[model samples]
Target: MKQRNGSIQQSKLKQAEKLLQRYEMDTWLILTREGSDPSMPLLIGVRSVHQAAIFIRQDGQHLALTSVSDKGNYEGTGLFSKVVVYEDSMEEVFQELFQELSPAKLALNFSASDHLCDGLTQGLFLWLEDVIGAESLSSLEISSEKMLKELRSLKTEQEIERIQQAVDLTTDIYDAVFSQMACGMTEIEIGQLFVEEMKKRDVCNGLGNPYDPPLVCAVRNGLAHRKPSHYQTRPGDIVIIDFSLKYQDYVSDIARTCYMLKPGEEAPPEDIQRAFDTAIEAITQSIYELVPGKKGFEVDQVGRKVIEAAGYPTIRHSVGHQVGRATHDGGTILGPQRIPPRPEVEGVIQPGEVYAVEPTVIQDDGLPCILVEENVLVTNDAPIILSKRQTELVTIKKNQVI
Candidate 1:
């Protein structure tokens, strides 16, 4: 485990170094005031320093600047190589460092298009401008969004392992729910059951709130991304579950639909079954074209075409997105419009990238919507589905249901 953790850190460091080299940047400055509140939320790892400012140079050097009160906390992390403790003037400290390094170009976290790149607040930006002066501030440039995208897009072996573990645990929860789903249970009840199971297994919701879990189960309103309400499951009702388990800071998103059976009914309505099958086909077809080199929009088109051909209206949302530390992480997304339009995204898909393929189909009546979501990892050959795909609709008998 220790070796694996070390390997992941090394991989991240190597990627950071390569990004610096690619951009021809002299230094990458990540200034943060608090530890848990990192420069960017996605970069906040276990080794992150709190109540300190961190600086990473192009030469793979780390320097942490913090006050005496928070110096001990940053030092305890043992992540930074050089820990510089300051007593009351960050401006003076930064000036001295600026004079010494005097990098031709300093890359700061600021981008108009990318949310991750825009981590630096407006107030912080003004402060930085004041300290660095107008000339030096103008010389400072924004870090390429591609650098941030690539750094987060490529998952290390440990990250993959943790995500896989989360997938497996979620699968178990699905199985357990499948075995007990029955008519008369409210959507909230079943959603709570999933949370209970995840808690039992020591998994947490990525939202970081212990009291509230990240479980969204909607009956008949699957098309709407709303929370589960007090509506109880009735015969012929479709209950859709959209959930994920956060394990070791990694997340797994999975969605499945369950059908409530009437007292004498043995199978779901043919139309319901057809909708479910069409959703599955859309999801499977989307995965087929999820290779590295293809444009993200192209992959989305594959699924949209499948659904449209099946006589269903196009899904309102994107086919899928890249998943990592946060539920929605990274720049390259498998959606209708690929952001940036860079050739690198068109570059062949490499191993170690994980994504979630979610395809939804709504009935003409605007009633229940069938949604199938599964996490997948892009390999050299083809994408591997991490979460178990819903092969058939889960049926819950009236009396036998939870």
Candidate 2:
């Protein structure tokens, strides 16, 4: 575990240096206290209880200015080349370090667009302004969004492996719970079965409340994100489960569609199968566009075109979003350009990013909308499917359920 942690730290440090050089950033400053910044663990390998300021210069210099109480946390990792501890005031040390670097463009963690890059709080910002004077602080480019988008969104080999494990476990749980599903089961009951299985594995929900992980929706519920209700699933109803599970701090997002078969019916109606097929094709075509250097919105258009050309209403949500530490891991979004927070969708895709591509088919018929989500990893050659793809509808019979 220690060796793996070191590898992650080394890999991230190399990536950060490359980004700093590419962006012409002279220095990258990270300030956190009492675990204030969520990105600290990813950037520094450990969260500090006391105040700390980590500086990374484009020339490959690494330094940490931390309180004496929390000196070992940063020093123990061997990540920083130098560790300076201050017992009283950090202003003198911080100012001295800034002057020593004499950075032309200092990058700070603050952004109007992305929360991942906006970890520096308002109070901390004010403290820096006081320490360095407002004129000097304001002159430097403070927003690290451009650099952080690449740093955080791009997953390392270890990160991808953890996400894949989470995906595998989630699909296994689905397989077990689906076999147990039967007629006369309420939507909530079916959801509970998933929760029970999750307990057996000792994992938590990837996104929302743990007790209510999967969003169980029947044909009558449409494609809403509401909690599972007392509504009982009947024969010939399409059941969609939007499920996710967190394993070792990584999360997987996958949605599966199941058709409850009537006694005589061996398969779903023609229209339902057609809708499912279209959704599957949309996922297949969109994943092909998930290569590095492609724009997020450009990849989104491929899936949108597939779904729209199939005579269904345009998908209401983005075809895909990044999935990592958080469900909406806040990097490039595979969505339309006009969507609010346009910068997210407009960002360029990079290798090592994992995305959950979900395309929804709106139905005018009595059936509900069909949705199938798959988690994919972006690579230089081709995108890899981390989750087992839901190609065909999962059929459940009243009596055959075990």
Candidate 3:
């Protein structure tokens, strides 16, 4: 399916406004240059402004301060509400805003823990501090996390549509790979093929685009995170393809492993098959126990226990993480480490939140590892799988010969 840009739902904006109010912040400012870096995702949804300093004040005022040279570029974008062209200094613009709004507390993007809040560089922050002056700067606080997290975690109808399209396209690519997969194909060849198909489908949209395609193919029996190499696939080898695509800035991650077979070969090594089955069980258990009120660590333990009970090594990574603009979008993760018993995460698994439940397991011998991942959307009762999950091990043969 051809992917298109999705609009940000007004409901999400309202939700954000409510969240800001809850945080007790009177005004929020999203100040950035060119609206590219950390603000790109948010600005992309904006319908007005261009080449300007974008500001979304607390009183619901949207201001765009830009240079005359680039005013035309943003004027037609329909992203900003008001445009202010600055030929020299932005001091006047700042002064006017300060006097008009006179906000008690101004929220700036600067979080020590979250990368999303750190989008405002040190230099730009200094400039903003100077612009606000000593008194206003003191009133200005760094607590944009609430706004950033709420904006990203809550998806709009349009954003959901775009993400669904990306998920469908990824499923199609997987089907195509399954049809032409062979035992002798090298890992690089497989990865390149996936990339070619993504481009043909025009799936490049948000971060890690054409340069770092979401689809990653790796052929390592035991190494889960190894980069794709030129190593040729052999019979009985376990091949894994871990990939995702960013649709309208949101991300979807999926992974599947296939077993190659020699001519006349009916099955994989008994041990490998056992490991694969165990991994699948872990995933199933994890999904079954996942719910709105449960802690992330609790869900992770369900999966971890399954693998350990099967006499397999525990997965080094978390069971899964929240998926959004960035692959590892901000919010609580479904892992043992992040989801501790005490001081639990604040939010629940809302219906709109998207996640990846990837359960991994390593066999005792450490030769072959099994991993299965799928994107899911939380519902009132059960989570719905966005990408098709691999139920059985895929078998690829050297040729069609007898």
Candidate 4:
């Protein structure tokens, strides 16, 4: 479905106003030069080549201060209440806007934890200080981390629909590729099949890297994010395929495990079955705890505990992460608190936020790790599973050939 950008921008601006009130900030000042801040496109749906400042206020007023070249871009949107264009110097106009707004607690797009919120450059920050002077710089004490996190994380209805479309497309591609799988095919060859299918659909890789192969790993390979290798798939090998595809600007990330059976074997070995089941159980229990208002680490603990109880090694990575514009979209992370705990782990989960929950079960023996990742949407009630959940391990028959 094609998204209506106009409606989305209007909704976003309204949400920004509410977030401003929640954070007790007067204005959200986003400074950009040559499209520096990534949030600018998200906030204003426009990119500026020259220096620009977007002021979104708590009173639902929006203003844009930009070079004359980019003034039409902001005005065309009609989302901003005022568009102030400057030709020679932005200092005078910027100063005038600041004085008129008199934001006692100005929030800037800088964060200590979330990278998405840290778009202001060090040079621009120093320049802003010089423009506003010391006393006024003190008023720029607030960080737009938490507020921006919510603004981006809480997906609107249109966004959710767009993401759902991406998930469906990825799931279909997985099915087509798995159905065509055969024993003795090299990992690279199998990955090529996925590339071919994605080309037919005209969708790009979710990671946006042409070299980023859908991590196809045979039994001997470890659970590391690497390109597909020349290792050939053989009988009795457990193959894991971690794949993602981008639809529109949203992304879908899902992983599936496949077992290549030996001649005349009806099922996979007992150990393989046990490991896969353990991973599935971990994902199931963790998803149940993924309710709104819960901390990211709390959801992570549920999966970690389940994996440990099943006699597996402690997982090295987080159970899940926020999924949206980017595969590893920056926001609340479902992970453990380490020696120096991540501030993002303490971030609260909100309704409308989608997470890619991947609880992995690693084997010390020569068995492959079982990671059945699912894209889930957090709602007021039960979490909605966006991708088709992989329950049983996909088995490739000995007779099957590519």
**Model 2 over residues 199-317: C-alpha lDDT tens digits?**
99999798777656599988765558888899998898899899889987779999998888887898888988999999999999999999988998999999999999989889989
Error of 1 at 318 (Å): 0.6
Candidate 2, after superposition: displacement of residue 82 in Å? 2.6
In order, the Cα lDDT scores of the candidates are: 0.72, 0.86, 0.68, 0.87
Q: Is candidate 2 or candidate 3 better by TM-score?
A: 2
CA deviation > 4 Å runs, candidate 3: 1-6, 9-12, 34-36, 43-52, 205-226, 338-347, 363-366, 400-402
**CA shift of 329, model 3, Å:** 2.0
In the predicted model 4, the residue pairs found to clash are none
Per-residue alpha-carbon lDDT of candidate 1 for residues 25-79, written as tens digits (9 for 90 to 100): 8777766654333333344233333334566667877667777777765565455
Model 2 / residue 364 / CA error / Å: 7.4
Clashing pairs in 1: 35-50, 35-51, 182-401, 292-349, 293-349
The superposed Cα distance between candidate 2 and the true structure at residue 257, in angstroms, equals 0.9
What value does the lDDT take at residue 86 in candidate 3?
78
Cα misplacement distance, residue 52 of candidate 2 (Å): 2.3
Cα shift from native, residue 328, model 2 (Å): 1.7
Q: Specify the highest-TM-score model's number.
A: 4
